[model samples]
Target: MSDQGSSTSTSQTDGDFEGELDEEVESEEGVKEKGRDSPTPSLSNFSASLRAVIRIKQKYQAMKKRRQEMVLGLGAGALVGAPGRTSPKIFTFDGLTPSAFPTLSSIQQKKKKRRRKRVLFPTGGGRKAMPRQERSRATYCLYLLLAILFLQVYNAIENLDDHVLRYDLEGLDKMLRREVFGQQGAVDGLLSHLKDYLSTYVHNKPLVVSLHGPSGVGKSHLGRLLAGHFRSVVGETLVLQYYVLHHCPQEANALECARNLSSHISEMVERAEEEEKIPLFIFDEAEHMHKEILDELWQLVASKQSNEYLNTIYLFLSNLGHGHITKHMLHNSSSISMAMTASGRHSNLLKELTPILRNTLEKLHPLWTEADILPLSLLEKRHVMECFLDEMTREGFYPDHTNIERLAGEIDYYPGAEGREYSQTGCKQVVAKVNLL
Candidate 1:
């Protein structure tokens, strides 16, 4: 009975230990359930939850801000007004809110605001930047002005035809008529032929003419006139004139004159032909030079064998055949008259006198007289009076015809010359007489 009581007590102790363990376990379960249901949790657990939420919110805010910054950077990079941009875009920030994320237009506006406040100098200046369009236009205009200046410099260097300050062809002819008297037909013939000759040197033949007439005539005057009028046709140093009386030293005989002439002619011809220019040689007083000079002269004209001299124009003036010329004019005295436009007896004079003059020249110098015979006729009373009146007009003064005739009476002429009483000295003394008047 003692053993059974001992066993029963042991069983009751085990039951009690089990029952306490179960109550403890049940209490722990109830506390866990209460903590899960209650608003106030453990301090450490509440703090851990709060830290996790704060970390997540910070990550999300950082991501959003980064995305906004990327958009702003993109907008700024895309649009800046610069030259050579084909497609232009304008950005605006009208209704954008400040707190909102930065948009493309708003970011662009911010960039522009910063730029406006920024310095501009060599970067920009004391004033606002000059507009890009205005700057570009100014650059282009400056370039154009430089180009024009360069072109002007080139033209000035070339110096084409403007070297001749005066180009007056017709004015020359009128002046010739005013200065010379009683030879309009001869002067007109010279002008017509010279125009054709000078322009086309290689086309036909050069003009070779000999002035055959009386003394005190205008042969030397005409030669000088030609040289002065066409001054621009050649270089200033190209004119060559030979007066027989002015040949080297008074002792130079015909042979010396011939030698000097041929040598000088050859050199001048070479220069003129090489440069493709027309040179003028006026040989005056063939009658005075020895027969040998005449022969050299004839060879120069007739054969023209010197290729160098082919382009030169030769004018030989002399009183060689005036005796025949005077007889012919006196023979045609009844028909002789002077008109401004009419060739009159002067036109027929060449045909009749050419044969006579050619025969005389041919006999005198062993050469074929291949030349244009220009006979300068005698000055009539009317021509003299007109010349006097024109001279007074040129001197800025005027005089009546009565005074001119009275002054002209101081001159003398042969009486039996078929009423053709041209003065013994022709018009040579008239100038002296006018000075006295």
Candidate 2:
């Protein structure tokens, strides 16, 4: 029985062992089958991986296009981000992507290009545009205007110091003759001295003239003539006429005249030196002017700036010393009565200032008359006739020249004067005389 039991156990043990081994082999097969069923890496898997990678790249490309569109939209221009479109979509991105947009210059260039294309392909042909001749004329006009503007500017700059330092004395004489009638010798002498004085014009060395003559003589007339002629030399002509009886009478007004005269002169001469012109100050009826006024003038003449003020002429017209001059002439009547040759004798008479002149004027301005004091003499018959004709012409009356001699004989002369000689009024009444004719 022991043997039997042991053999049975052995058989069981073997059977169990066989079963276990079979199960083990089956588990191994199952494991191998599972492994085979699962996915295996191959060429097809590689292709599928490449396809995934291509899909990601396409997504990235789309994002870049969106970003570019957003950047173009953000450009600071009204005509920006593709024209004729509004409400453009803004692109979104991951962290802090740098933005870019088109510049104004680029946008302008694009607009210009579009305009050129439109112009080249207009609705009509080139004939529809403005005419070529008119367009060319407009362009030429613009060029000419610019050229004229440039020339005017250039001339203004160049003429800054334009002044007449030297002038034609003979021309001045001719011009004076045309305007001022009779007193040919006086006119000629006045201009000759004036020309010579102006030739040596320096700052303090002014051309001072004391026109001492009879009341009706051409003292004031000659002054006007000088101013007119001076206008030709300087581009501008202005006279500061101080009619002593009119502006500031002698007595109490002389001091007032002195003060006002200084101011007046200063104003006229303020820019005179700068503009390169000599200021003309005419003291008419100068004998009537106070000694104080003369002193004031002397101060101006002696001023340091006076030496710099060139070509300035101070004209003093007066009848103060005429009586003395006439008396002196009467003493030497035979030689001096001849009006034509009276010019040379005038200097000699003035040199020996007659009793009345020496007393009244010598104390006033002793040196004022040291230079040539022009003494306008009485006019003769021939001079009066010429004066009458000139007066007629000035009055716009073209009376016959043949009637001039006959017309002059009718004008009245002084009691001592006869034979068509001038009156005591000289050429003063000549204008009225011609008017009556």
- By TM-score, the best candidate is 1
RMSD of 1: 21.0
What's the lDDT for residue 257 in model 2? 82
What candidate 2 gets wrong by more than 4 Å, as runs, is 1-166, 235-238, 249-251, 302-306, 309-311, 336-360, 365-371, 398-407, 414-422
For candidate 1, the TM-score is: 0.56
Model 2: lowest-lDDT 10 consecutive positions:
157-166
lDDT by residue for model 1 (326-398), tens = 7776677666553425365667777778787888887876643667768777666666666677666666555
In the range 1-437, model 2's lDDT, one tens digit per residue, is 33343345545655655665566557555655655676775666556556655754665566556545544444323244335334433334534544456778889999999987764334765656642453667889999999999999877645432222345576777787776554665676777766566543344466676677786667787777666666666545345667878887647777788888888777667566666556777788887777778878887765555444445678878887777665554455455545545456555554676445646666778546433466666655666777777778888888686788777677666544333344566667777777785
Q: In model 2, how large is the Cα lDDT of residue 264?
A: 76
- What lDDT score goes with residue 417 in model 1? 58
lDDT of the structure predicted as candidate 1: 0.67
